[model samples]
Target: MEHNKRFLLVHPEISRNKYNFAGIIDNEPLELEYIYSMLKSMGYEPDIWDGQVETVSLAEKLKSFMPGYVYVCGRTRQESFMKEYCANSKEICGSTTFVGGIHAQHNYKHFYEDSIDFIMTSFDMFAIADILCGKSLSEIDGVCFKSGGIWQENAPKPFDAERLPVPDRTYFYAHLDRYRYLELLPCAHVRTAYSCPYRCKFCYRNRLNCGVYSARSIASVVEEIKGIECENIYIIDDDFLVDAERILEFVRLIKKNNIRKKYVCYGRADFISGHPDLMKQLKEIGFYYILVGLEAVSDRYLSDYNKLSDMSCNISAVEILNNVGINIMGMFIIDLDFKPRDFRELYKWIKSHKLRHTAISIFTPEMSSELMEQYKSRLITDAPCDWDYLHVVAKPSNMSVKQFYFHYHILAAKLFIKGWREGIYDFVDYGFYIRTILKNMFGFGG
Candidate 1:
């Protein structure tokens, strides 16, 4: 499929685990960069409208961009609002449109009805391109659409990640402050690899072992980093340190350029726990925050979430990072599967670990991986995609959703209040709550 085209990609601030908003890490929309590069590769231009910094009236923006297709991706949180706006955008533009991402992909036709023309789920970008190039949705894979009052499914093609060009970081550079936590100039987010190679039950990318992760060559990656003239960048790799040789080459490239940018990337505790000295070097090379998923302080509990990493590894990794003077934002998941008694231990765990700058999200069934598989089996409620539900997703193996949410809320409240008293997080400090009180004259977290 080959034809000239143009597109507009919109990403909603949907909740991955509901509470992601409570401790939002303002970041650039990498999906836009990916699609921008892919569209540019296919001789098309894409304008991205990210709704993170400010709410965008997409229809008004669409009139200016006049794209051939408008694409939106988000899960549970703001589906109704997004669907309404995307439908309105299509109506206003009089152009065909598609909506994707996990929520839409799994239940596009079921949810949006006549609003969306096409839905792409399960890493089905190629099929989407083909459809936009004028192929029928029936011919694509990982797409769903309503046809004659029925939802039709297609089996489409998936492309090799290495074949794709580096995401044009210009869009990101143009919208720097919109990213939540960066206090730098020329901040860009770069994805080093396409799919993840983990089997963590809560993650979205591990939907199917996608493949032995194919990585972009260090030479190619560095070319883009330098080409962008970036003084700082966020290595948006799911886990760049997973592949050590690539890590060495990547670090070497930054060292050679002496060109610098602060980087933030996700990683497994096992990776850092095993290579503290190397990670210390990465920090000097602009890797500011190594966001590790220290899901729990217990191997048994963490294993229940399929974290794979042992509790000792998680602690050791955090210790190493702190010792190396690297700021750590340890992400932990409080299970809905435990009793109220679990909260005391978890709090003790956090305090003992001195885990400041932490984030807690309720578990959610985001992708089609183990989480969703279990969710659909009546094990967990589709865990509402609301921003508040960020951490505990569903009925735990042994607790009701109500009991789970109640205790989970208590735990988070304890953490936030404790930190507020001690001045742990900046944006979420007491000042923010005071402002909210003055504005809304109500308690916070509404």
Candidate 2:
């Protein structure tokens, strides 16, 4: 046990496909910020160096910080870098290395090497404090570690979001200008809730937090919003619009306190379509952006994915949001079963509806996603890193892999170009997006 130990939080560097604007936007690592605040409360000094935004080398930062413990957080895409950074940090400072977040939570078995010392499977700050305080590893719930050359893990305790500390945003505020969401530059992200309540077959959220929904109190959320110095606030909740009463309360509190900030949050089609009045109220209270998962245009496809909401619901949702003057960031999935006509129909629907902002990801069964088990044998690449949504990982049923990509490239180009011509995004962003698309199209691999 060490007293008053300094800890360093590292966000592993991972490359994103430059073709997508959403992929390239810099975002505050709120997860690490939460961990940092927890460590501080435990009387440990904590500092964060984000690989996505920081210019210094991890080794250089490690050397300068000379922390007794190094904690890394990342998704599956950044697994290799996480391992590498932890290994390097251990070499630099003999730091006890720990890993957490999505990659480590579900795939902790993959990280039980000598280089890594511990992995956190839950977001419980008390569990984390106990571990750092040198409590017996076996007794610490929600932590996985090796004892006497044997790997062990305790049963995870349920996470209560209400019990969590308000994330100390001092570090994030210093780097606020770097984070953006398309046109919403300098965006600050906060989550009012964790995980989604609805079971969408393709989502990996179930693995992240046992598919249980936990929400912070409205008063706490409003307090966080009021402290945000950034002009734009991005609510990273999986489904912020799920509870109509909660939404109404949040809006009421915001107006009551005179707290104002441009906002964005996720919503389901059914929720928006069913609650037009609330959507209007949201817009009136500075909610100008909403990211809706309009997975497909076909009701059968929606049924196949178990999206719960059908095409008509998606249409109504888009129309309602548009009518209220809220910018909709439509998200769609490109299934392997799609024929050329399906692509055409999807584009036609977008055009007919005049949908300006959109995100189209190939139906990727990312590691730990429920759909991955069914599509495992169908995967073209065994490389875990290729599971990023940018790649076509699964074998197409209706067409060859090459042909599926050919149509994908054309569809992507058309979507971006159309958006640009229609002035959905700025001209500076348009040039970068166009260039990235061209590079990926003619390049060796996407």
Candidate 3:
């Protein structure tokens, strides 16, 4: 509501599941919504254009809403292709386009001479207002812009973890049907806090954020929930149950509000093993599932990756969470170390215990992860993200790339069939899987 302040926030509609090469991937753009809400809090009028509805006519939105600036969040591996299209669209419409997010942030220098007027990292979205209101670009922090044919970099302004805004789900409200398992409600995503306490090597959060973490007050959260209409909320926090006391407070508030919605969130096994009561309470409050990064099943594999999750905790945590009747989506990374028996154990475990789903990703050393640094000398593919190489980037000391790729897909197909047999299909949002199967079996998705 700041007079004379207006912005058009664009959450580039990207392939929801990375493998989709055909249909427009329609998933909630949680990160851009966060920026939109922040702009609103700063008194700026903001409009959301979920690229899935149709190609963004930057010209149409600017002529209609007449916002002075644009804020966008795009991913690296998956949505990299859409960035240029969005920037060109914005330029064609005559709006100042400022881009942010992991890909834009890391490679701002790489794509400096385009329709992107400014490139930013995870935080400091508000400062963009300063740029649009005629303030000298020099005063704005966390922006990378061109001057005199050269790109100037400003220190990334801190992501105000404490003052984080509730994302504006209205952007995706009408188009909720495009997402996986979200047709059930006008689903929304909220972060209980900002930044993860741990810094895993292969994660952008670790490479970009600080060791310090911040949690939103339970009262503030309940107030935000009052305005959202969805019955199912996906807690997009890096780890929702990280703070046990805060979760307890959140659960109590939900009960008091008489809100009824199932929830899904990320959690760490060590933390869950330490506090079963929180998991139990979360389960009581419509918390239907938890996504835990059980990176590896063996201690050697986990220690090698610095994940700090052991096979013992993996087994125990799965059993405990299941005992509470809350489904677990165990994410496991397959490497040369995991043999055919390990594969059998993993599938058997999910089938026997009834896990919601599992992402058996053949470890692709993420952008700045330790795996990337460790294997950079021996990496087979170095291009930012071809998507095709997402399966075989990280070759184990023992296995061949072809071997890893073949086993990876074969096992994944088996797991999909297994989940289908058990009637547990909505667990993982792998639209890419359906697209791949269709392309081969029915000649579609390409």
Candidate 4:
């Protein structure tokens, strides 16, 4: 038979828990769409299978499509599922399996298995195309592959944001109703930058692209935004509110182009607090939501994490966003050194600010981060899925694991009740979430 050129790109499903906030938020697999577009540009047929929204099983898809190549991408939380999908693809169709993403980039050794044929350490689409054209795997610079039953890795090249093609959104448009962000139904994702600029110790995003930051041209970003079918655009940058002049130009271009769209993005607390004028300009440009990382309410924790912002900045950020009528999704991190009183104090602080939309995550030191070395001695779990920030993966200094979970659950329950009463998250099923929380608290289905 002639060499098959069909490709199947998959997005793995996540483990179910209250922390997943499933049904509340299901983002489109933008990465797979990028791969799909690149493959199509190369004159190869490619299909996407998003496990979050797909009803059919992987086995069924593999049998039906009979693709010659299968590619899977996901974060650390989806590591197990990524491997499983590759194993299934190899077993069912004997397809060439490729695995890549943030997790695979940093920990390629974990995927050195017989089922996986290649591991991409960077977004080198041309290298992938070369492989499809019968080029030897050893010739690729940023990929790992088996040679004579031995795994060999090539040095990674620097990633260039300019080389990325505009992601084809045919799959997104086909399943428009399945993707959402809280109340923002049928939302779309857009990226203006690669990696992050800051050096927060616990963040893995800044470590991407070899710690280099690059932004696409403002004109190109605006052009892409104007073509999007959805009114809600989630600018999926690590921090969209980085450069004042750049952001001002973006706002100006949006107005000039007459492109009306609501926006969501990540921003630093210090930026929002210092540039109240910029915040006002963003609000005027239809900025509906900003997810600020108010990691902790204490100055000590901020300094320890190298966050470069104090609690005062966080307070001012909330006030500024509230005044501008922009919703603030405050993300907080709970440290292992927290005592029982600390959780109560954090809850009290959140309530005092009248912040209805708050996300509390346990501090998890990623395997790819520098903080992992410091926590290695105190580590509790080696499982990749347990590092999702929802699980306590390290020994606590002030409390036992059970005690820490008890306090954390209590805090989450309180916030959930407050959010429910205020009608902040009416789109999600309240009963279902409440049941999930209880089950996790009691260790029934956790």
Candidate 2 lDDT, tens digit per residue, 1-446?
35338899888666654433443467788888888888888778899988877889999998898999888998776788888999998798899888898778877887888889888887675777788766877888888888788889876766877876778887777876577777677888888887778888888774456657889999999998898788899998888998999999999999999987899899999999999999999999999889999999889989988888898899999999999999998999999999999999999999999888888888888676557788989988866566677778889999988888778878899998898788776625556667877777777245
Model 2 Cα displacement at 279 (Å)? 0.6
CA deviation > 4 Å runs, candidate 3: 1-6, 16-18, 21-26, 38-45, 53-68, 179-184, 336-345, 352-356, 387-390, 426-435, 438-446
Q: Summarize candidate 3's per-residue lDDT along 145-257 as a digit string, tens digits.
A: 88887889886745665576677777677666554332334456766676687766445555554344666788888788767777767777777767777878898999999
- Put down candidate 4 lDDT per residue, 308-405, tens digits, no spaces: 99999999999999999999999999999998888998998898987778999999998956799899999988988887888999999998899899
RMSD of 3: 4.1
Q: What is the lDDT of residue 101 in candidate 1?
A: 61
- Ranked by TM-score, top first: 4, 2, 3, 1
Any residue pairs clashing in model 4, and if so which?
none
The TM-score between candidate 4 and the true structure equals 0.97
Backbone clashes, each candidate:
19, 0, 6, 0
Quick one: RMSD of model 4? 1.5
Index of the highest-TM-score prediction: 4
Q: Give the winner by lDDT.
A: 4
**lDDT (0-100) at residue 414 of candidate 4?**
95
State the C-alpha lDDT per candidate.
0.67, 0.83, 0.67, 0.88
Candidate with better lDDT, 1 vs 2: 2
